[model samples]
Target: MTTTPAATPPGWYPAPDGSGTSWWWDGGQWVQPPQVPAAANPTTLARLALATQILLVAGGAVAATTIAVEGYGVGVASDYLNGNDTSIALFDLYDQGTLVGSIAAIVATIATAVLWAVWQFHAAKHVAGQTRRTPGWHAGSWFIPIVCWWFPYQNISDLWRAIGRVRPTWQIAWWVLWLAGSAVSQLSSRVYLAAEDLEQLRISMWLSIVGELLTLAAVPLACLIVRGITQGIVQRAATPAHTLVA
Candidate 1:
C-alpha cells in the first residue's frame, strides 16, 4: 500500500519534491522570509554621551575665555573713560581684541547649547532602559523663556525625583554643588556689572574668581553623578530573571 506524504506546516514551505516546497510566509499569505535587523550595540550610546560631553566642555571653555577677555577689555575701557592716560592706549588694543572675543564667545555659546541638547537627548534615550519613561521633557523645559530662568532649580528637583525613583538615598551633593555654583556665578556677574568704584571692582573680581572656582568644582561633581547614575542603570538592567521552583 502507498502512504500519503505528511502535510506541510501552515507557515513553512514544503520540500522541493512533487511533495511541497517550503512556503514563504508573508503577512497575509506565504511569501519570502523576512530579514530581521541586528540590534544596536549598547556601547554606541555611551560613546555618543562621551562625545557630546567633550563638545560641551570645549564649548564652555571657549565661552569662558571670551567672557574673560570681554571683562578685561571692558575694565581697560572703563579706566580710559575715567581719565587714565595709560589705559587709553590699552583700550585701543583691547577694543579690537574684544570685538573678536565677543564673536568667538557667541559662537562658543551656541556650540555649547547645541552639544548640551544633543547630550541630554542621548542621555534620555539611553536611560529609558532603566526608567519606565523618558526624561527628555525635563531637558526641554530649560529653554522655555521666562520659565527657563527659574527652571534650573526645578530641573534639579525633578532630576532628584527621577534618581530617587531608581535608588533611594542617591546622594545630592552634586546637585547642591551645581546649584550653589550657578547662583554664585550669577551673583558675581551682577556684582561685576554693578561695580561703581575701584574697591567695588576689586571685590567683584574676587567674587567672580570664587564663583569660577566653584563652577570648576561642580563640573567634576556633575561628571561623577552621571557616572554613578549610568552604573546604577546597568546594574539594574543586568539583574537576572528569577525562576520559581516547586
Candidate 2:
C-alpha cells in the first residue's frame, strides 16, 4: 500500500522547480507561489517600508482633517437653514480639505508603490540569501494575473521564517482591516464623487472616515512587522553559524 505525502508544515518550503526562491506552506498547499527577482539590500527594503509608513500616517491625518472640515460644514448648513445671517461659506472648508487631501493622497500612492517593491525584493533576497532572485520577477509579480495575491503572501511568510521571526496574531487582523479599508475607500470615493447634494457627500465622507480608521489601525502593525523582520535578519547575520548550530 502507498501513502500520500503528509500535509506540508506551516513554514517556508523549497520551490518545486528548484528555484532558490521558496513558497510558504500555510498548513496546507492550496496553490503554487511564483518567484521574485534580484533586489536591493534587505535594509534598504526595510527603510523603504518605514518611509511609506510615515507617508501613510500623514495621509491618515490629512484624511481625518477633511472629515473634521466636512463635519463643521454640516453645522454651518444647519445654522443657515435656521434663518441666521449666513456668515460663513462652507465651500471654503471643503476647498481647503480638497487641496491638502489631494497632495497627501498623491504622496501616499507613491509611497505605497515603493513599499510594495521593497517588500517583494526583500522577500526574494531573504529566500535566496547570498544568491538572491532575479530583479525582474520580484518587481513584476504583483501585476501578474491570479498570481499576485499568492506570490506576495508566500514571500512575506517565507521572509518571516527565513529570519526566524514569528507571525503575530495582529498580522492577520491587519490584513483583514487593510483589505476592508481599501474596498470601502474605493466604494466611498465613488459615492462621494457621484453625490449631487451635500447630504450625500457628507454620508460618503463618513464612510471614508471609517475606512481610513481601519487602514490606520493596520499601518502600525505593518510597520512593526517590517522592523521585526529587519532586526531579526541583522541579528542572524551577526551571530556565527557555529553558535546557531550549537
Candidate 3:
C-alpha cells in the first residue's frame, strides 16, 4: 500500500519526491522548490563605489580651485585698499580669475554632491531592504546646511555600523582619513583668519594650500571606503544561507 507524507507546516514548502526537500507552501498546495537567492558580488559593488568617489573628487577639486582663486582675490583687494596702482591691476586680474573659478567650482560642487547623494541613497535603499530598517532620517541629515558639515560624520558612523552589522569584516580606514582631512582643513581656515600682515598672509596661504591638498587626498580614500562597504554588502547578500554562520 502507498502512503502520503504528513502535511507541511503553514507557509512552508513541501519537500520534493518525499525526500524532504523544503518547498514554499502557497497556503493551498505545494509548489516547486524555492529558487536559490543571488549572492552579492564585491567587485561590482566596488566599481560603483569607485565611480561615486571619482565624482566626489572631481567636484572637490573644482571647489578648491575656486577657493584658491577667491583667496587670490582677497589678496588683490587688500592691495587695492592699500592704494597701490600696480597692485590694483594685479588685483583686477585676480578678481576676474576668481569670478570664473567660483562659477566652475559651484557647478562642480553641485554635480558631485548630487552624484554622491544619489549613490548613498541607492546604497541605503539596498541596505534598508536587506535589514528591514527604514533609512529615513539618517539619509536626510546630509542636506541640512550648517549641521550637514559635521552631522554627516555621525551619519557616516551609523552607516559604518550598519555595514558592520551586515558584514563584520568591512574596513573603515577611509572614514578616518576623511575625518583627519576635515580637521586639517578647519585648522588651516582658522590659521588664515588669524594672520595679520602680508608676510603672515603668505604663510597662511601655504597652510591653506596644504589643507586643500589633504582634502584632495582624502577624497580618494573616502571613495575607497564607500567601495569597500558596497562590496561587503554585495558579498553578504551573495553568501548562501547554508554557508553563512549564525
Candidate 4:
C-alpha cells in the first residue's frame, strides 16, 4: 500500500486567479491573506486625484451658471415668440456662456474621467493582495457599460474594506448621488433636445439644475474617499503584517 502525501502547511501562495497577489492557504482551506506592502507608492496619484476633483468642481460651477443663463433665455424665447421685443445683446451673452461653459465642462469631465481611472488603477495596487478583484477592475469597471453603475462603487468599497475598515456613509452617499445625478442629467439632455416649446425647455433646465447640484454635493465626498483611502494605504504600508489587526 502507498502512503498518503503529507498535508501542506499553512502559508501564503500565489493567488489562484493569477492576479499577481498572494492568498493564505490554511491547512484545509483558503483564508484571508496578510497585507502585502504595495510596490509603488500611491501618494502621487492621490495628489492628482485632488487636483482633478477641484477641476471638476470648478467645471460644475461653470455648467450651473450656464444653465441659469440658458433658463433666462427661455423667457427671452417666450417673449420673442409672443411678438415682444427681446434684448438681442442679452441673448447673445447667454449663447456665449452656454457654448463656452459647456465646452469647458466637457473638457474637464473628460480629463477627470481619464485621470480618475489612472488613479484607481494605481491605488488598487495597495490592496491587490487583500481584495478578490483584480487590480485592473478598479479602472476598467468605470468604463464598462451598464455595470459601470455598480461595479465602480463595489470596487471602491472593496478597496476600502481591504484596508480593514467598514464602509463609510460618505461612500454610500457619494455613489447614490453620483448615480442619481447622472440619470437626471441624461434625462435633462434628452428633454432639452426634444423640447418644442419654452415650457418644456424650462422643465429640462430645472432637471439639469437639480442634477448639477447633486453632483456638486458629491464632489467633496469623493475627495474625502480619495484622501481616506490614500492615507489608509500609507498607513498600511508602514504597519507590519503581524501587527495588523485584520
Leading candidate by TM-score: 4
Residue pairs in candidate 3 whose N, alpha carbon or C atoms collide under 3 angstroms: 12-25, 13-23, 13-24, 15-21, 39-238, 40-234, 40-238
Least accurate stretch of 10 residues (summed lDDT) in model 3? 237-246
What's the distance in Å from true for residue 204, model 4? 1.7
lDDT of 3: 0.58
Q: Candidate 4 lDDT, tens digit per residue, 71-179?
A: 6776676676577765545668766866886787788778878878877777887677777678888888898999898989988888889877888976889999889
Indicate the worst ten consecutive residues by lDDT in candidate 4: 237-246
lDDT of 1 by residue, 40-115 (tens): 2335445555665665466456546645754675577577557886875665665576567547646765665565
Better of 1 and 2 by TM-score: 2
lDDT of every model, 2 decimals: 0.52, 0.62, 0.58, 0.73
The lDDT leader among the candidates is: 4
Which 10-residue window of candidate 1 scores lowest in summed lDDT? 237-246
* Candidate 1 Cα deviation (angstroms), residue 5: 44
- The parts of candidate 1 lying over 4 Å away from their true place are 1-41, 63-71, 74-84, 126-133, 146-217, 234-246
Over 1-246, each residue of candidate 2 has an lDDT whose tens digit, in order, gives 112145646655564446565544445342344332334234566666567667666666765665576566556655655665553576677668767776777677666756666665665565565323343466666667766655655555656777776666677776787778878888888988899976676677677777767777776777676677677765664342321100
**How does residue 237 of candidate 4 score in lDDT?**
65
Assess candidate 2 and give its lDDT: 0.62
Which scores higher on lDDT, 2 or 3?
2
Sorted by lDDT (best first), the order is 4, 2, 3, 1
RMSD, every candidate, angstroms: 11.0, 12.6, 9.5, 10.7
